[model samples]
Target: MSAEIMPYVVAGAMAGGFINGLAGFGTALFALGFFLVVLPPFQAVAMLVVLSVITGLQGLWIVRAAIRQNTRRLARFLLPGLAGIPIGVMILSVIDASTLKIVVASMLLLYGGYFTLRARLPRFERATPFWDMLVGFLGGILGGAASLSGALPMMWCTLRPWPKQETRAVLQPFNVAVLAVTTILLALKGAYTRETLIYLAIAIPAALLAAQIGITVFKRLSDTAFRRLLILMTFVSGLVLMLRAVL
Candidate 1:
């Protein structure tokens, strides 16, 4: 990466790490918007996958206790997500990158809009394994395609009758597993180059530092406040994704 481009990349990493730290998701949405400005789509997605793993690890540590207690429940969501990943990886190899970005952006916009109007919308009942697996499958496809596996699960958790901590417990680990798979697939595809390593050297530290700051902010917010913030950020992320595609 050029010296001039490094700053934007670091800024994006920090912003992404912060959001992921706070809400346990959205690292790609927040980071890729800035990265897409300076990097090609493949390179940017590769970098975000690496950073997503870093952020996911950090987030897991923050919520370790909840994860331990709910491991069984989480497995219901993760197993099918694992099954769906290879299909998503195949899509990534074959699909037009620009078209994928537009599709992802449109999904984000619709997801955000739905949540913004959630109060007016009818409430969903408790989550069933069928729905969990369905969303997890979709999330895996998106994750493999664009490092966006978390969005659907995040939105799903909000609609379900879960508390904030439980929501984090499930999605954080799920993201870690999916992104870990993404990284391996990218490596198999030889997406990582010398430049990618250099970018990671810069990104990892920025991401870790910002994640801590976000965790601090998350600790301070009430459950109600956190949910509202999550909704707003989702909407903002969608707008950013769409703008990146157009401009």
Candidate 2:
């Protein structure tokens, strides 16, 4: 990457990390929205995969106890997610760059719009195992393709009657596992070039610092406030992604 581009990369990483810390997801949506502006789709996805693992670890640590208590629910989402990653990766390998960008950007726009009007949206009467698996599978595919595995699950979790912490417990660990798999697959596929490593080195510290700030803020927020902030961020992320795709 060029010297001029380093600032954008760092900014994206920090923004993504902060959002992930605050909301327990949206790392890819926010990070990739900025990254695709300065890098190719593959490289941008690769970078976010690595950084997402770091942020995921942070989130998991914050919600470790809750995760242990809800192991069964987590598994319902995770087991299917594991099955879906390779399929998404395979699609990523074959798809053209422009098409990939459009698909990812469109997903962001659609999901973002959904979240923005989520309060007015009807709620699910009950959670089903089938819906959990489907959401996880779709999330895994998106994760493998563009490091966006959390969006679907996050949206699904919101519809349920769970509190904010419980929602984080389910989504954060699932995101960690999916992102870990995606990172490993990318490494095996030789997606991480020397430039990617260089970018990672520069971006990690900024991401960590920003995430800490977000985590601090997150603790003070009520469930209702958190949901509102999440929807607003989702909408903003979608707008940014759409702009990147069009321009």
Candidate 3:
């Protein structure tokens, strides 16, 4: 990349890493904005996923206890999630960046609006294996296409009766695992380029540093406040996505 672009990417990586480390998911959203301006949207998402794996690995380690406790639930969603990854990639290969921007932007807006209005919303009545599989499948597809799949199944977990920690733990590993597969597929499909690797090297550390800061913040935060923050960020991210699409 050019010198001027390099700085923007590094700044984006730092912002993405810090937000994700603090919030557990905003990395891709932030990266999306930065990369879309610097690269194609699909390429931006693919590169972001690679950087996310590096950052997410740190998150997984910090939440190891939570992961262990929710292994079974995560495992339940793995197969379907894995199965759907290629579908997302296939879609990405065919669709132009403009279409992806519009579709993802619209989805984020609708999802954010709904969640913001009803932070305490319930899950689908039939959140059984069938629904889980279907959701996982769709999430994987979207993930492959846009790297925004992290929010979908997580929304399902949020409405469950479990304690917040348990819910978060259950989703973390699954999100990481799904992203891992999606990243690999994207790389194989030619999303991984020399510039992408260079960006990853710089961005991954930013993610780790930000994650540590987040851990500190998380330790200080109350659960109710954290929930409110999550809702607020989701809404903000939706607006950002919409703007990216339209502008």
Candidate 4:
């Protein structure tokens, strides 16, 4: 990459990494704005998945205990989500991705805005494995169809009263897994040219450091605060998605 573009690469990495560390997701939503400014859509996306997965590993280690405790719960969401990915990819040939993004973004704005303004988040203490599975499956479908894997799952998780670690245990790993698959698919499609690798070298370290800073802030937050943050992020993420699709 030229020196002219290096700033965008570093800026994208830090923005993406900080949010991922803070919330255990959202590397793409935050990073793409900087990236699309200097790089093509395909190359920008290629770098994002790689950054997300690498930075996500740090988040995974932080939530390891919660993950071990709720392995079954995670699997209920993950396995079905994985199964839905290929089908979502198939749907891509037939669907208008931009339109689908708008629909999902509108739902996010409606749900996120309403709940964010309220005094409290909704609760679902019951362990509904079936619903969890359904959300995971659809999250995977969205991931495949429009690169929106986290939208559904984040919305679902914010409803509950789970501790921050438990919530991160679900959201962090789910995003990493989906994005890992995306990275592989992109690799097969030759998205990772030599130039992409050069950009990744500079981006990765910046992303890692930013993620650590985000994790520090995340660690200090109360459970309620974290959930509120996620809700607020949902609203923000939806707005970002809507703008990217429209403009």
Candidate 5:
């Protein structure tokens, strides 16, 4: 890579890492933009999955106890999400990814905008294993098709009043699992060449350090604030998503 490209790589790593550490998801969504500027689409995505999973391990550790305590709940989201991945991959053959991203981003914008204007956050206190699974399944499909696995879950989890750690436990591991599968598939196709490994070496440390900073900020937020942060992120992410698709 040229020296001109180095800044964008570092910027993407830091951006993706910080978001992953703070929110337990969205590394690819935030990082991919910077990467796509200088890297091929396939190479950007290949590196993204790796960076996402590697940095996401820190998030998993942050909520390790909550994860253990809520394994069953996590499964409700994860197993379905995993099942949907191949289908999502299949969808890519028949559908236009930019169109899908635009549609979803529009929904996110509206959802985040409408809720932000309301005084109270929407709360769903009832146990809804069915809904959780559905969200996870759809999220997986999106992840597979558009590398957007976290979007649906991020929307759904904000409706619940789970503590920050508990929410991270779900979002963090779900993303890691989905992206891990992607990483494997990409590896099988030989996406990781020597050049890619060189970029990974440059990216991993930048991401790890940035993520640690995001974790510090995450630890300081109250439950309500954290939920609000997710809500705000949904809006920002949607805007960014739309721009990426359109541009």
Candidate 6:
């Protein structure tokens, strides 16, 4: 790898890592968005996955908390979710760039709109097994397409009856396992090449360092403020993605 490109990779990873650590996901989405401006979509996706694995591993420490809270529930929810990963990766292997970008941008817009207008909606807090499966499938599909596996699920899970700590905890292990499985599948599909690996080597540690800062910042914020910020970021990110795709 040329030293010339190393700084850019590190900078991108650092920004991605901070966002992921603050919000539990978005590193890959952000990184891919940035990289796509400079590289081919496949190469961008490959680079995103590499960094996701690093961020996932770095954030895996949150799993201990989940295990302590509700090992049985986590096992049940995450195991089914894990089973969807390979299928998701298979989907990714065949999807073209325009199709993926359109679909992902549309989803972001819809989810962002929903969150933006959430307060005006009727109260509905029922969680059926079907809902879990649906979310798992959507997470897998989106994860494969755009590495957005947990963003939607995170919001939904947090709104569930589960404790805040437990909800957040479950996400890390589930995400790490998903990334691990998908990474192998992506490699098998020829997504990750030597050049991507070199970029990843530079990006991973930078992401981890920024993630530490994000964690500290996240911990300091109030729940209300966090929720508001999450919605705002989602809205802005959705707009950015939509504009990127349309333009």
Report per-prediction Cα RMSD to one decimal: 2.6, 3.1, 3.3, 0.6, 1.1, 3.4
The ten-residue window of minimal lDDT in model 1 covers 118-127
Estimate, for each residue in 1-247, the C-alpha lDDT of model 5 and write its tens digit: 7999999999999999998888887888789889988999999989999999999999899899999999999999999999999999999999999999999999899888877777899888999999999999999999889888989999999999999889888999999999999999999999999999999999999999999999999999999999998898899889988897898
> What TM-score does candidate 4 get on C-alpha atoms?
0.99
* Lowest lDDT block of 10, candidate 4: 120-129
Instruction: Give the candidates in order of TM-score, highest first.
Output: 4, 5, 1, 2, 3, 6
RMSD over all Cα atoms, model 6:
3.4
Report the backbone clash tally of model 5: 0
Clashing pairs in 5: none
lDDT score of residue 158 within candidate 1: 62
Residue 38 Cα positional deviation in candidate 3, in Å, after optimal superposition: 3.9
TM-score of each: 0.86, 0.82, 0.80, 0.99, 0.96, 0.78
What overall lDDT goes with each candidate model?
0.81, 0.79, 0.69, 0.95, 0.93, 0.67
Superposed on all Cα atoms, model 1 deviates from the true structure by an RMSD in Å of: 2.6
Clashes of each: 0, 0, 0, 0, 0, 0
Q: What would the per-residue lDDT of candidate 2 be over residues 96-119, giving only the tens digit for each residue?
A: 645665776676668768767766
- Model 2: worst 10 consecutive residues (lDDT sum): 118-127
Name the lDDT value of residue 184 in candidate 6: 79
lDDT, candidate 1, 1-247, per-residue tens: 7888999899999988998889887788778778988989899888887888888788889778888888877887788788877777689888875677778678767877887877642347665888888988888887667556777787777666555677788988998898888789789999999988898899989999999998988888876666666667667767876786687
Superposed on all Cα atoms, model 3 deviates from the true structure by an RMSD in Å of 3.3
Q: Candidate 5, overall lDDT?
A: 0.93
- In terms of lDDT, model 4 sits at 0.95
Pairs that collide in candidate 4 are none
By lDDT rank, best first, the candidates go 4, 5, 1, 2, 3, 6
lDDT of 4 by residue, 158-245 (tens): 9989999999999999999999999999999999999999999999999999999999999999999999999999999899999878
Cα shift from native, residue 23, model 1 (Å)? 1.4
